[model samples]
Every structure is written in structure tokens, then in C-alpha cells.
Target chain A: MNPAARSADGSRRVLLMLLLPGLVALGVTFVLPLLWLFRASFASSAIGAFSGGDWTLSSYETVLTDPFYWLVAWNTLVLGFNVAVFTVILSYPIALFLARTESRWRGVLTALAVAPLLTSSVVRTYGWMVILGDQGVINSTLQALSLTDGVVRLTNNSFGATVALIEIFMPYAILAMLSGFGRLNTQLEEAAAMLGANRLKVFTRIILPLSLPGVLTAALLVFVLAISAFVTPRLMGGGRVFVLGTEVYNEATVTLNWPLAAALSVLLLVLFSSVIVIYQRALRALEA
Target chain B: MTIRTSISRRAAVASALAIGLSLLSPAAMAQDTSVTGTVNVIGFSGVFAENYEKFIIEPFEAKYPGIDVTYRPSKNSAETLALLTLQRGNPEIDVALIDVSVAIKANQEGLFAQLDPAKVPNIADAPDWARLDGDRAVAFSQDNLAILYNTDNVKEPPTSWNDLTDPKYKGKIAAKLGDTRGVILLPILTKLKGGDYKESIDPGMEMLKEIAPNVSTWEPAPDCYAVVQSGEVDLSICWNGRAQYLHDTQGGKIAVALPKEGSIGQTNTIGLVEGSKNKEAAELFVNYALSAEAQATFAEKSFYGPVNTKVELPDEVASRIYGSKEAQAAQMSLDWNFVADQYSPWIQRINREVIARY
Candidate 1:
């Protein structure tokens, strides 16, 4: 072989050698466990032994046929979608500000936006609990202002859970949108404005279309994170709001029903995968 | 040559120190030689673990200089069982302290070693009911469920379990879901309403639904103690040990009530993990844990009722525990195996029918 060709082959071999360890690590840690979980999902309720137990579709049947499981599944999807929508809406202005601002306070604002991510979700959820509790700051202020005769229940419900989830996940949406906004060329919007187009028109026609990918990316990230979130929902919802994540935790740890938990998990995975696939296809069509 | 001379001199000094220690405590020296390894323990975390360390683990370590005790704390018995099951093939933990019902389930799963009475003579001290699966697990401590009320908010203490359903407590009662204390509420309610666990829990479910509006939170994640202590909820259903601990430590703000109907008993059991590397040391630790001295100390400090029949707690401590004959009679007995089997469906019903309706 020629020297260049031989060198090219050697480089390829070296690259494969470099990738081998990571590939093996992922296979052992991620793939192997995932396969084991899938197998466990099919086994009966016998604990300890992962295999050699009666193999059955009972776990999946329980998950599928149970109305309670369906309710939890619906709650999970709705929560994910609502949190995603709310996060995107709340984060857009912040992202735009971060992208457009040239002032020194831009860094301060960015840091403030991302500050919650630095602390644990559990701690932040606890903070929300204090603020939104029955006799919390909101209620006290409401009482002081004589807004109402009695305390309003602001927590231990869906509203409290959603608010906490949005607060925890908004930073991720903002960062994703900011990255997208950074890639935008300002000249198109400026030209649109010069042509007597209004701000709304410019944003709708030019800016939004250009940033579709970023918006979708942000929504996807927030949706996945929010749906699978255990701490925030468990703490803020006060257990009044049941979701799949909490159900999985209860089944696995509280009830010791690993097979059922695995089934529920696999269901969550399939649902999310379908949604992601559809989303990607739609995005492709939009781009085309 | 100089390095070798210095090493030999250091070794001679270590030998002299060992000789001195052996002379000081010959029994410790004998134990030190026999059980010379780390006994890794998996058990409860939080305040209970702190008390265990102070009352049981520390004393055991002091008594047996050769056996080092390493504690790995778990959040709950279920989590401990899951861990044990996961580590069944290559067991990492030598000893485990978990809830008795969960220990029974784990035993059925073949996760615990059959505890040899010859190795652990203190096994005889525990009552007959305390022993399970031919000594695979021995109950060491017991905690009872109790009604906890915030003293500041609650002027009239609740004397009955049905007080939780009172209209006055509307939007003020906190209950933890997916916990033993929460699940036991079913039987408590069933008995109060003149129903049995065998026939139907519908009466209890109906009562739970009726009182659902009064439940401020159905799932107090960390615990019901903080929620009650914060005065967010006037009353809660919680374990006596925690309620008593919180009452003593948190400025006497919380008080526990053993309703006239009685309370459910939650027994904590300790066992040696099957396939443990340090089986001898683990057995020694288990035996030490079941001793009267250890039991009395733990019961006095942690307010957990001792399962060892030989334990002689002080009067004040005895008053706080379910140790007296009358108190023991008042303690509700549960078929834990039945409860374990029924837990998932009951929890599901609570989540769907009761909490969802709320």
C-alpha cells in the first residue's frame, strides 16, 4: 500500500482503539442494565430471583388495564406538556433579553436566570413549599391586605407542582433558546422593520421561523426533565398529585414490585420515544 | 541498612503497644483475634441511625476491637430489601436492620442467612413472635403508630383515631402515603368502624374518602413531623418514636396520642446477609444488638420498644414504650405477611380513589 493510504488506515485503527473503552463502558453500564430491566418486566412477582420465576405478561397487563395507572400516565403526559409550554413561554423573553442586551447587567441577569440550577431541585422545591404554603408569605400578604377572609390552598395540588416544576426547568429552556438566538442574524429583522413591518410581524414571520429548532429543542429538554422529575412533584404536590415518576418510585421501593415498576418505566420510555420521533419528523417537514 | 533498622524498631514498638492493650483487656484481645474484619451493616438512616450508632454500634465496636463496624444507612425497609435483592449474588452488606414485615419478605426471597442460635445466644432473649423463619430474622425494636398533634395549634388533644375526621380539623390533617404508618391507618380505621381486614376495607376507604378534604397533604415526602412542627397542619398520623423525639427535641411543640382504639405495632428486625464475607463478625454484631443492655439503651434513648423480654427499662422510659403488660395488650397485632401482599393494591386504591377524589 502507498504510505498515505497506509497512514489513513492506521489513523482509523487508532480511532477505533480510542473509542473501544467508552463503547464497552456504555454497553456494560447502560445497555446491560436496560436489557436486565426489560427482562425483569416480564417476570412474575417473585422477589430476589430476577430469572427462573414464572414468566408472564401480568405486569404489563396490570399497567395497561388499570385505570389508576392510566390516570397517572395521563397526569405525567399533561404535566410534561404543560411544564414544557409554560417554560418556553416564560423563558423566551429572558432568552431574548440575554441575546439582545449589551449592558453590563446582562451577565447579572443571565446568572440570576441560571442561579436556581446551581442549587438542588429538592432545596428549591422546599423553598417553593415555604413560599406557597397555607400560611406562607403569599397567604400572609393576602391576609394583611385583607384580600380574602380565609387562607387559600396554594400548595399540595397540581398548581403548586406545576409552578415548582416550571421554576426548576425554566433555566434549561432559556439556555436552549439563548443558544438558538445567538445563531440568529439581526440583519433580517432590522431589514424587515425598515420595510415598515411591525415588531409583531417581524417576530412572527422571520425570528420565530428561524428559531423553530431552538424552540423545539427547549420544549423537548424541559418536557423530558419535568415528566421524569420525582423530587419536585413529590414534595410540591404533597402526594395529592399522582404521576408516573412517583408511581414508579412507590412500586419499586415502597411496594417492592420491581416487575410492575419496570413495566411502567418501559411504557414511559415508549411514550416519550414516540413523541420524540413524531416531533423530529415534524421538524424535518418544517425545515423541508 | 539504616531503613531496615528503623522499620524493625517501629515494628518492635507496635508489638509492645499491642502487648500493653492485650494486658489491659484480655477479653477484647481474645475477641480481636477471632473476629478481625469489617462488618458492613445496612440499616435505617436519619435519627434512628444516629441513635443506633450511639447506643448499639459504638458499644459493639468498643467491646470488639478486632471487628470494625461499617454502617450503610437506607431510607426505608423497602429500599433496604431492594438493595439486598440487587446484591444477592455478590452481597456487599454483612448485616441488615430492616422492618420485620420487609425482613419476612426478604427471607422468602432467600436474601438472609439462617441465623445460628449457637453463634448468637441472645436470640433466646427475644420473644417467640420476634423470631421469624427459624431465626433468619430477629425483631430487635418496635415502634407504634400514633396520632401527632401540634401542641400550640391543638388545645384539646385527640383521644380517638376518628378525631382526624372531625369537621374542626378540616384542611389541617397531614398524612404520609406509601409508608407503614399510612398503610396501618386502614386497619386502625377498619377496627374503629367495626370492620375486619379479612372481609372488606370498604368502610375504611369510605371513611378515608370522607376525611379526604381534611387531609392537607396525603404525601408528606420527607416526613409528617416537619409539616406538623411548622404548624402548617394541626394534626398528623406518624410513628410514636419520631413524634416523641420531635416533641422532646423541638421545644415540646408536638405530642403523641395512642388513641383509645389502640395503635399498630411496627417491628424492626436485624439479620445476617446471606453470602456475607464476614459472617462471624456479623453474627457477633447481631447477638450484641439483641442483648438486654443494648435493647434497654436503645429503647431508652430512641423511645423504640424493646423486643428482648429480659430488658429492664427505667420506669419513665417504660411509660413511654409499649412494654407494660397492659400497653402490650393495647398494641394491635397485624398479619404482616397479609399486609405485605395487600399493600400494593391498597396503596393504589388510596392514590386513585381517596387522594384523587380530594
Candidate 2:
């Protein structure tokens, strides 16, 4: 073999050796647990000292046949979709500002945009609770200003939960969009503008099309996070809002039905995977 | 050869140290069994655990010098049971504190060790009702489900559960769902409507549907306490202990009323975990916890009613608790085993039929 080819082969072997540890770690931590969870999903009984017994499809049957669970599933989907769409729409301008600006306060502003991510989501949800509660700041201000006759119920409803979820998950969308915006060729937009394209036209035709990948990525991230969110819905929605995540928690902890929890988790995983697959297909078609 | 000699010398020194430590361990253990090892306790987290530590665990540790007590707080009884089940045959927890219903279930599952009367003599101090499954578990504290109303908003204190159905309370009541308070509400409603748990809960369901429209929120306690305290809701159904504690601590903004009809009694239990390595230490702690002094201290500090029959509470504390002995005697006694079997179905029905319609 040529010396160059041999050297290349040596480097490939070294690369494989480096990758082995990570692969092993993922197998043990992620893959193995996932397999166990899948097995637990089929257990017959959800009671007693042991978690598993005979393999059965009863858990799946119960989840699929129950209209209550279906309602909860629908609510979960709607919440996830709404949060994802809103986060992307609200994040685009911030992402653009962060990516395009060379201003002195750029770093500080970016840090401010990302500050919510640093705090615990539970703490942030509680903060929203205090602000949006019946006698909270918003209602009190409204009452004080004579803008409303009585206290408005905000915290213990879907509206409050969605608002809190969007706030908690927005930083991820912004960061994803920023990364996408950073990759765009600014000269393309300049060229379009130089050719008499209006600002709106440039944004719609050039900027949006170029940022599709980032927008899609951000939406997917936010959707997954929001759909699987337990704290925000539980705290902000205050038992009024039922979702798949809360159901899973209720089953596992309150009801002590491990099989049902595992089955529901599998359903959530499948739903997310389906969404991701369809999203990728749409992205591919757009590129083509 | 020199490197080999050095390795041998190091091995010999390590063996000598291991032997010395093993010899010292028994002597250390012999001096005082209480202080020599650690007792891993699993119990409620948040305010309850803090109070438990302050009134019970700390005082016990102070009395039994050299014993290290480690408290691992659990979110709830079900979670604790799940953990105990997971750790069965190789128990990580020496002692566990959980809801009485959960204790019954755990006892049925054989997760607890039968308490020896000689070891836990204070077990005799507890009421007969408090003792469960032939002393496998014993109730340590009790709380009652009561009507809670905001002092600023409620002009007249509610005297009956039917007050919740009054049109005057429309859009001013906060209902709690998927909690012990919510579950007990059904039994109370059933009894008020001339039915019982063993017979039919249809009347209770109908009543729940009627009251559902009045409810503005379904936030559970602690949150429900905040809602009532903030004067956001005129009234709520909550536990007397927590309501009383919050009322006293937060400047008397909330007050609990034991409805004239009756209130449900919720009991909290303590048990030794099966297969515990620290069984002796755990038994000592359990015995101490069930004693009149410990029960009285916990009751005074947290406003929980003590299960120890020997505990003589002060008038102030007793009045705030389940009220007079006659009133306490009137408090509804639930068959927890039956409730455990029926809980999930009832919750599902309430969620779908009642909460969903509301």
C-alpha cells in the first residue's frame, strides 16, 4: 500500500477508537433504558412489589380506547404546535437582531434574550403564576386602572400555561434561529436590494427562504420540549389542563401504574418521531 | 526486585489497616448502637419534612448521640412505595413515612416489617384504628378535610358542604382535583345525600356536577391555600392542618371550618421498611416518633392532630385541630383498602365526566 493511504488508514482507526467510548455510553444510558421501557410497556399488572409480570397488550388497549386519554393527547398536540409556531414567529426578529447587529450592546442583549434558560423552569413557571394569578400583578393593575370590573382568571387555564411554555422555550428557538441566520449570505440580500427589491420583498423572498432550515429546526425543538413539558402545565394550568406529560406523571406517581406510564411514553415518542419525519420530508421537498 | 518489595510492603500495611478498622468497628458499635451507624429515613418533602426534621429527627438525634440520621424526602406516598418496590430485597431506606392508605397498600405488598411490640412499645399508645395490618404500620398524625374560606371575602363562614353548591358561591370557589381532598369530597357528598361508600356514589356525582360550575379553578392545596389567602377565591376545600398552619403563619387570612355535616379524616403512617440493614436504629426512631412527647411536639409545631391517645393537646391547638372530642368522633372514617381499590376509577370518572364537563 502507498504510504499516504496507510497514513489515512491509521487516522481512520484512531477516529474509530475515539468514537467507541461515546457509542458505548449512549448504548448503556439511552438505548438500554429505552429497551427496558419498551419491555415494561407490555407488562400485565401495574401493581404490587414487582413492576413486571406477563407480557400483554392491555396497557396499549386501555390507552388507545379511552376517550379521556385521546382528549389529553389532542390537547398535548395542540399545545405543542401552538407553542412551536408562536416561539418561531416571536423569535425571528430577535434572532435576526442578534445575528446581523455589530452594536456595542449586542452581547448584553443576547445574554438578556437567553437569561430565562439559566433559571429553573419551575421557578420561572412560579414567577408567571405570581404575575398572572387572579389577584396578581396583571389583574390588580387592570382593576386599579378600572380596565376591568372583576378579577380575570389567567393562571389556572390553557392560556396561562401556553404563555408560560412559550416564555420558557423561546430561548431555544431564538438560539436555533440565530445559528441559521448566521449561516446566511448577507450579500445575497444586498444584491436583491440593489436590484430594486423592496425591504418587504427582500425579507419575504430572500431572508425567509434562506432561513427555512433554522425556522424548522427551532419549531421542532420547541414543539418537542413543549409537548413533553410537565412543570409548566401542572403548575400554571393548575390541574385544569390535562396533557400527555401530566398523565404520564399521574400514572407513574399517583396511580403507580408503571405499565400505563411506559405505554403513554411510547405513544409520545412515536408522535414526536412522526412529526420529525414529516418535517424532514417537507424540508427536503422545499430544497428540491 | 526493589519495586516488588515495595508493593509487598504496601499490601501488608493495607491489610493491617483493614484489620485494625474491623477490630475498632465492633468496639465502636458496642459503645453506642444509636450513634455508630446511619438510619436512612424516607418521608414527605417540603414543609412537612422540614417540620419532621425540626420536631422529631433532630430531637431524636440529639438524644441518641453518635447515630447519624439521614432524611431522604419523597414527593408522595405512591412515589415512596414505588421506590421501596424498586429497592425490594435490598432496601435502601430504613424507615418510611407515608399516607395511611398507601401504607395499607404497601403492607399488603409486604414492603414493611412487622413491628415487634417489645421493640416499638409506644405503638400501644396509638389508637386501635391507627394500628394497621397487625402492627406492620401505625398512624402518627392526622388531618381533616375542611371548608376553607378567605376572611376578607367570606362574610359568613360555611357551615355545611352544601354551601359550596349555593348560588352565592358561583364563580368564587376553587375546586381541587386529583388529590385526597377531592377524593374525600365525594364520600362527604354521598353521606350528605343519604348514601355511603359501600352503596352508591351517584348522588355525590350529581352534586359534584352541580357544584362544578361554581368552581373557578381546580388548583390543589398549597396552591389552593394561596388562592384563598390572596382573596382570589371566596372559598376552597382543603386540609385543616395546612389551612390552620398557613392561617397562623400568614397572619390569619385563611380560616378552616369543619362542616356541620362531617369532615373526612386523613391519617399519615410510619413503618419500618422490609430488609432494612439498620432495623434496630429504625425501630428506635419509630418508637420515639409514636411516643406522646414526639406526637405532641409535631402536633404543636405543624398543627397536625396526633394519633397517640396519650397526647394531651392545649386548648388553642385542640380547637384549631379536629375540634372537640365529640366533633372528632363525628369525623368520617374511611375504609382505605376499599378506597385504594376504587381510587383510579373514581379519579377517571371525575376527570372525564365532571372536570371535563365543567
Candidate 3:
């Protein structure tokens, strides 16, 4: 072979070697199970009929055609979007604080952000339950201070549960943004200032544009977490609210409809993957 | 120059430490499968884990020295069912100690390995009432749903399901929900309104709605005992075993009573997996699990009534469970199949109507 072709072959082999472990892991753990689940989704409820019981689209039809499933899907999307928006809003300021703060307090700031992530979701949500419940610490304090006449209806409310999720997932976005800010060079801002540009102008033109990557990363993380969050919504929302995660849970566990649940899971996976791909494309376009 | 180098070195060290921490977490958790020859049974919590291990696994492992047994406790039947479904084909579980509702569903789904009663003689000792279709499963223990109330909260514990909805106890009650269908309340609720459990949905739903506002929360876990123990709710719908356990551990704050109309009783069952490698061992284990000694141990520890009639429990244990003549006579048991079938719709409706509004 020619030298260039030999080098190309060598590079391909090296790439394959590098990618082998991840590919094998995914194939073993995820791909094969998903394939089985896909098959199961088409299978009939009749026993020993693993195959050839009419490969119908009935399961997918059930999920897509049903208003209940659609409602859950819409709720999941809304929850994801709200979480993403809130994470960006909350984490942007926190990221700015971490990036601009004195070095001594950086550890403390990071610790405060990371503390919630380190704990179990169930424990954190349960803590929220105690704080947000009727006759809870918050309500009791409010009452004593004459802020309200009675204990507030907070524990079982959707808005309260959403706030709890936002609080729980904020750290990831903030941390990612902080790292992004660290990588960002302050040269453009300094150069802008040298030209007598105002601080606001310098920031808007330089820092905001530079930090877009990190902000995107944070939003993506929040979206993924919010969409897949089962425990927080189940426990704190008290099953009064429904989402795709809970719907999948109810289908598989409560209703014993494996095919339907699997179909729903597949839909979720597809939606999540599509969103991620679109996000990356958008990020690339913005960068260009 | 030395000072600048030292500061840079300190920064390098900090970066290394942060990177190390981030990398270590996933690596630490990647040690996922270290299965070293053990039998794993996943199911709900209670005396089943302890009794099964003590009487069944330990003895079997004694006979077969190399075998190790692991018991995984699930919070509820639905969770157990989910876990089983997830672990299908490559089941991390060898056996599952599950409720009748879960077992029946599993049986229908071919999740369970059917047993030959001729192969498993201990199946005979299981109460006929506890058997499902005389085929796939056998009862190990009965977790009877009894009326448990804090004596201090009421002058007398209500003798019927009707009294629970009385205005006197408004906003001072709690109830079980989700997979815990309160099958025990079905018969009593139906009989109180002069109907059978199957035809009693309207009345039952009405009954639930009356108490819905009063119920502080629809506890989906057996840990509802802790709620009562904390004096958060004056009275609650609780299991006999839970009441017995809490009363024993924390003190006699809660008293368990079998209502005159009779509550629903549930029998927790054991069955062999359909494709078990060791059907002989599984049946052997089940036979021993249903033995009188095992039953007594389960009764004493879990406060659940034993299905084995041959087993004689201690007076206090017997009195606390559902095996007593009065307790047995009063129990208004319903068809578990009916509950399992209708449960999804009923819960969805309840969630939409009562729980969401309340």
C-alpha cells in the first residue's frame, strides 16, 4: 500500500481501538435490551408467543392515540422546558458569582452548589416535603409572623414541586457554566474597556457571547434531568401530577402493560435524542 | 521566580484534585456486578425476608454449602413487579417472595415458573383460600389489613368502615393507596352498603371521597406506621403486622382491631420461577418455608398470620394476627383479580378527582 493509505488505515485502527470499549458496553447493556424491549412491545400478551403474534403497531398506537399519554408527553416537555429556563436564570447569576467571587469563598460557593447533587434525590425531595407541607416549618413560621392565616397549600402543588426540581437540578448548570467562564478569556472585555466602551457593552459583546457554550451545556443537562425525573415528581407531586416518567412507571408497574411502556420509553428516547441533536446543530450554527 | 512556580504548582494540584474527584465517582460505581454464587430474592419488606432466610435459605445452604443467598426488599408490589420485569431472562433474581396480586400478574405474564403440586408436597399445607387457581403459587404468610387506630385519639375504635367517614374524625385520618388496594376494606365497605365487593365500586368510591379530605395523605408505603407514631394523624388504615410491630417497638399507642364487617386479608405467596435451573431446590425450599417452624417464626416476627394450619403461634402473636376464629370469620375478603384489573382506572380517577382537588 502507499504510505498515505497505510497511515490512513493505521489511524482508522487506532480510532476503532479507542471506540471499542464504549461500543461494546452500549451493545451489551443498552442496545440488546432495547432490541428485546422493542420486540416485546410488538408481542402479544399470550404466553410463549415471543414472536409471530402479528407484529402490530397496537402498542405505539395505544400511547400515541390515547389522550392520557399525550397529556403526559406534553407535561414532560413543559417540565423539561421550564426546568431548562429556570436553570439558566438561576445558574447564570450563580455562575457569575462563582466566576467573579474571591478565591477563598469559591470553595464555599461550589460546596453550596454541589451539596444537593451529592445527596440522594429522594432525601432532598423528602426534605422539601417536610418544609413545604401543611403545618411545616415554612407555614408555621409564616403563621407566627402573621404572613398568612393558615398553613399554605404547597406540598402537593405542581408549582411547588417544579420549584423543588429546579432547586435540585440548578447545581449541574451552574457548575458547567462556571467551568465555561473559567475557560473564557477576559482579553476581549479588557480590549473593549481600553476603547472606552462601557462595562455593560463590554459584557454583552464579549462575555455573553463567549459563555453561550456553557449556558447551552447547563440548559441541556437540566432538560435531560427534568424529563427523566421520576422520584421527585412521584414523591413530592403526590401522583396528583402526571408526566412521561410516571406514565411509563404506571404502564409497566401498575397496568402490567410492558409493550405499551416499552413503546413509550422508545418514544422518550427518540425525543430526547432528537432534542440533543437539534441542540448541537443549533450550537454549531451559532458558533459559525 | 520560585514563588510564581509554587503558586502555579498549587493551582495544578487543585485542578488535579478536582479532576480526580470527578473521575472517581463513575469508576467507583462501575463495579456493578460482583455476583459470587448467591441466590437473590427480591420482594416487599416485612418478616418474609428474615423468615425466608432463616428457615429456607440457611437450611438449604447448609445442605448445599457453596450456595449463597441474598434477599432484596422492595417497598411495594408494583416496585417488585417492575424490578422483575426489568430483570427478565437475565433475572438477577432466582426466586421472588411476592404478594398474590403481583404473583397473579406474573403468572399471567409467564414471569413465574409453574409448579407441580406432586413435586411440591408443602403446597398442600397452604390454605385453600390462599391458593390462586390451584396451580402456579402457594401462600407463605398472610398480611391481613386490620383497622388500626390510636386509642388515645378516639373514645372507641370504629367497629365498621362506615364510622371512619363520620364528621367527628374529619381531617384526623389517613389511608393506604396505590398498589395497596385495601382489599380488606372492599368486603366491609360492600357489606355495610348491602352489596358484594365486586358490585361495590360506587359506594366504595363514595366512601373514599368522604374520607379523602380528612386523610392527611394517601400513604403508599407500609411506613405509614411512623406517621401514626409521630401523632400526625389520629387514626389510619394500617396492616395488622405494622400495628403489631409499631406497638411492640414504640409502645401500645396504636391498637389493631378486626372490624365487625371484616376487613380484607392478603396472603403473601411463594412460587418457583418458570425456568429455574434448580426446581428441585426451589420446591424443597418452598416445602420447608411452609413448614410449621417457619410459619411460627414468620408469625412472631412479622405479626402476619401463617397459612400453615399445622403451625401453632404464641397466644399474643396469634391474637395480633388474622388466624383467630373471630378474626377469620369477620374478614370480608374480596377477589384479588377484580382489584388488580380495575386498579389502574380507579387510581387514575381517584388521582384526577379526589386527590388532586384535596
Candidate 4:
């Protein structure tokens, strides 16, 4: 072989060596667990089938056939979509303000945006429970301000759970958009302005279009998270709201129906993966 | 695969990795051991575990100096069940403390060994209802479902299940959601309406629906007791042991009431693994756990109602043990298996048709 080719082979070998540890770690942690989960999804409890003998689709059948499961899936989708949209709508402007400003106030705003992410999900959910409870701060404040006659229904309802979820997950979208904003080329905006275009025109024509990738990425990230969220919905939704995550929990734990739970999880994984792939493909097409 | 196919697969894998990493911190893995070096026990995270550590664990560890004892605590049975499942083949956990219903479920799953009654002679002293159950599980402690109310706010707390459903207490009442205690309430409610607590639950659902709007909130844990103690909630359904603890700790502000309509109770049971590595050690531990001395110590330290009839309990504990010979004459325990089987469906149905209406 040529000396250059020989050197290239050495570099390739080094790169492979460097990547080995991560591959092993991922295999052990993610890939193996997912395979186990997939196998479990097909499994039947003691009643429906014998102890791990046949490859049956009864679990999937039950999940597909059940109206309640469908309701849970619908609720999960609706809640996830609402949370993603609300987080983006609320955080985009804040993220923009932080990126555009050079003052200490921008730092303060950024810190405020990310503060909730520092706390554990359980602790934060409990905090919202206190804040959004019927007799909690929100109701107490409303009552004191004479905004309502008595305590208004808040946290223990679907709307309250949505608001709490949005609050908890808004930082993800904000940080995504913030990184995109950080990488934005300011020269193009300056050129548009020098050409007599107003700030709004520059933002709409030059900035927003350019930042679409980041916005889409943020939405996808938040949506996936919101769909799988278990704690917030279980706590804030007052045990009334049936979402996919809670449904899986109920099936696996209470009913002791592992196959049904596994089937539900498989469905969720397929749906989630397909959405990400389709979205990413669309983004690639738009970029091209 | 083709180069393009490989590249795309890599991209997908990379993105998935990024997403997972960004979302969650890697959870610590439990150490896997081949040798039965020590006995690790799994249980609920509460006064029960605290009492176990004080009375049983401390004494057992001291007595068996050669062997070590470890207690792993979890908040929910779902998590505990998951943990137990993970330790399935290896059987790292020697003993597990779970609810009576879960013990039945675990027994069905072959998660527990057939406990030898001969080894644990103390079990013979337990009530016939607890022992006669064909399952391998043995009832260890009893918990009563009662209404805990603040004395200052409510002049006269409800004495029976009828008093609980009173329209006046609407919007002030709190109860658990999707918990064993919460499910137990259904059968109790059904029983109150001259209906079967076992077969049918429509009446109970109706009762819950009627009180749905009035439920200020449905708490998952006994956090309501702290709220009631602080005067945040005037009334809520609470466990008897937890209620007793709260009443004792917080003073005369809160009071516990077991209504005349009769309430349901749950027994926390113990079972052994089917293929336990340390069969001798596990049997010895279980036998000692149900002994008269252990039961008395548990009652004194943990405020749990001891199941060992041979043990002489303090007056406070005697008053709380619902199935005690004296207490059983007045109260009835709904069939536990019936409660366990129906609980999931009833809760799911209520979540859909009733609670969702709000």
C-alpha cells in the first residue's frame, strides 16, 4: 500500500478504537433494554397464556381493540401537542429578547427561563400541586383580589395540568431556539436594514425563516417529552385524565397485564420515532 | 448494508442518543451479585419501614452478626414490583414487604417461595381469615381506611359512610386516587348502599361522581394529613395508622372517625421467593418477623397494628387493630381478593366516566 493509504488505515483504526466504549455502553443500556421491552410487549400474564411459550399478539389485540386505550392515546397526543405549542409560543419571544439584548436584564431573563429545569420533576410537579390546588396560591390570590367569589378550579383539572406541563418543559424549547439564535449571522439583518427594510420586515423575511430549523427541532423535542410525561399528568390531572403513560402504568401495575402495557409502549415508540423521522426529513427537504 | 443506508442509520442512532441524553440522566444500576453475600429487603417508604428498621432489622442484624441486612425503600408498589421483577432470576432481595393484594399477585407470578408455616409457628396465632387464604402470603399488619378531620372546623365529624357523603362537606373532602385505599373506598361505598361491594360498583361510582365536584383535590399520599393539620383541608379520608400518627404528633386539632356504616381494611402481608438463595436465612427472618416479640416491638415503634395474636399490644395499638377479636365484633373486612381484582377496573372506569367530567 501507499504510505498515505497506510497512514489513513492507522487513523481509521484509532477512530474505531475511540468509538468502542460508547458503542458498548449504548448497547448495554439502550439497545438491550429496548429489545427486552419489545419482547415483553408480546408477553402474556399467567391468565391469557402459559409462562413464556407462544409468540402471540393478544396484547396488541387488546390494546387496539380497547376504546379506553384509544382515548388515552388521543389525550396523550392532544396534551403533548398543546404543551409543545404553548412552550414554543411563550418561550420564543423570551429567547429572542435574551439573544438581542446585551444588558444584565437579558442574563436575568435567561436564568428565569431555565430555573425550573434545575429541580426534580417530582418536586416541580408537587410545587405546581401547591400552586394550582383549588385552595392554593392562585385561588387564594384570586379570592383576595376579589377576582372570583371563592377558590376557582385550577390544578386538578386538564387545563391546570397543561399549564403546569408547559411551565416545566418550556425551558427545552427556549434553550434550543437560544442556541439557534446564538449562531445567527447578524450581517444579513444589518444588510436588510441598510436597504430600507424595517426591523419587522428583516425579522420576518430574514430571521424567522432562517430559524425555522431550530424552532422545528425545539417543537419535536418538547412534543416527545410531553407525550411520555408521567408524573405531572398523574399528579395534576387529578387521577381523572387518562393519558398513554398513565394507561401503561395502570395496565402493568394494577391489572398485572404486562403484554397490554408492552403493546402500548411499542405503539408509542413507533409513533414517536415516525414523527421525528418525518419531521427531520421535511426539514432536510426544506433546507435543500 | 449500502454506505447511504449505513449513514442514515448512524444519523438516526445519533439523534436518538442525543434525545435520550438530553432528556434524562442515566439511572444508577443496582449491583448484581452471584454470591448470597447478605440479605437485602425491599419495602414501602413510610412509618412501616421505619418501624421495621427500628424493631426487626436492628435486632436481626445484631443477632446474626455474620450476615448483613439491607433495606431498600420505595414510595409506590408499582416501583417496588418493578424492582422485584428486575431481581427475578438472581433473587438479590431476600425479603419484600408489600400489601396483601400485591403479595397475592406476586404469588401468582411465582415471585415468592411457598412460606413454611412450620418454620414460622407464630403465623398460626394470626386470624383464620389471614391464614386460611390459599395464597403463600401471610398477613403481618392491618390498616383501616377512615376519615380524618380537623376538630376545630367540623364540630361533629361523620360517624358513618353516610355522614361522609353529606352534601355539606362537598368541595372540602379529599381522598386518594388510584391507590389501594382509594379502591377500598369503592367496596365500602357499595356496601353502604345495600349493594354488593364485590360484584357491582355502579353505586359506588355514582357516589364518587356525586362527590367529584366536592373533592377539593384527590391526593395520592397521606400529604392530606399535613394539609389538614395546617387547616388547609377540613376533612379527608386517611389511613388509620397514618391518622393515628398525625393525631398523636399534631395534638387535638385532628380526629379520626371509623363510621357506623363500616369501613374496609387491608392487611400488609409477607411472602417468600419460590427459589430463594438463602432459604434457611429467609425462613428464619420471616419466622422472627412474625414472632410475638417482633410484633409487640413493631406496634410500639411503628404504630402498626400487630397481626400476632399472642403478643400483648399497648392500649393505643389495641384500639387501632380493626380485626382484633374485640374490634372485629363491630367492624367487617371486605374480601381482599375481590377488592384487588375489581380495584383496577373501577378506578379506570371512574377516571373515564366520572372524574373526567370535571
The best candidate by TM-score is: 1
Models, CA RMSD each: 7.6, 11.2, 14.4, 15.0
Residues A1-288, candidate 1, lDDT per residue (tens digit)? 999999999999999999999999999999998888888888886472264467789999999998878989899999999999999998887888788788889989898989878999899898998899888899999999999888799989999999999999999999988887655678999999999999999989988888778888899999989888888888888887788888888888877788998998899888889888998899889879
Residue-level lDDT tens digits of model 4 in A1-288: 999999999999999999999999999999987887787777666333223555778888888898878878899999999999999989888887777777868878898888878898788888887888777888889998999996677866678779888988888889988887755678889999999999899989998987777788889999999999988888887666678888888777766677777788899998799888998899899989
TM-score pick, better of 1 and 3 = 1
What residue runs in model 1 are displaced by over 4 Å at the alpha carbon? A46-55, A104-108, B1-38, B60-68, B89-92, B117-121, B276-281, B312-315, B322-329
Candidate 2 regions with alpha-carbon error over 4 angstroms: A1-6, A46-53, A100-108, A182-186, A193-196, B1-39, B54-70, B117-128, B220-222, B291-297, B308-316, B324-326
| Tens digits of per-residue lDDT for model 4, B1-358 | 6999999999999999867755653321122232234667788787767778888987766556555678888776666666666667778778887887777667666787766777767777877666524537777777778788888888987677677657787667777656676677777777667788656888887777776766766744227687677666678887777777767776868777767665566677777666678777776677777777777777766556677778787665656545344444556665666666776677767666666674
Interface RMSD of each: 1.7, 2.3, 3.8, 3.8
For model 1, how does the per-residue alpha-carbon lDDT over B235-312 read when each residue is reduced to its tens digit?
Answer: 988888978888898898888876766777788899999999998888999999999878988999999988899987
Q: How many clashing residue pairs appear in each of the predictions shown?
A: 0, 2, 3, 7
**Which lDDT tens digits does candidate 3 get at residues B1-358?**
9999999999999999868855864432232232225556676676556656675566556555545666788877767766666566766666778888778887776777766777667667766766765557677777777667776776687766677788777656667555455444545565667766676566666676777776666642225676566565677787777677778777788777666665566768776666665555555556666776567777787777777878877676766776356655775554666766765566666655566566
Q: Any residue pairs clashing in model 1, and if so which? A: none
DockQ of each: 0.54, 0.31, 0.14, 0.19
- Give per-residue lDDT, candidate 1, residue B175: 88
Provide the lowest-lDDT 10-residue window in model 1 chain B.
Answer: B319-328
TM-score of 2: 0.86
Candidate achieving the largest DockQ: 1
In model 4, where do residues sit more than 4 Å from their true spots?
Answer: A46-53, A102-112, A182-200, B1-40, B57-70, B74-90, B132-135, B220-222, B251-254, B300-303, B309-316, B321-328
**Model 4 residue A243 CA deviation in Å:** 1.8
> Cα deviation of A7 in candidate 4 (Å)?
2.2
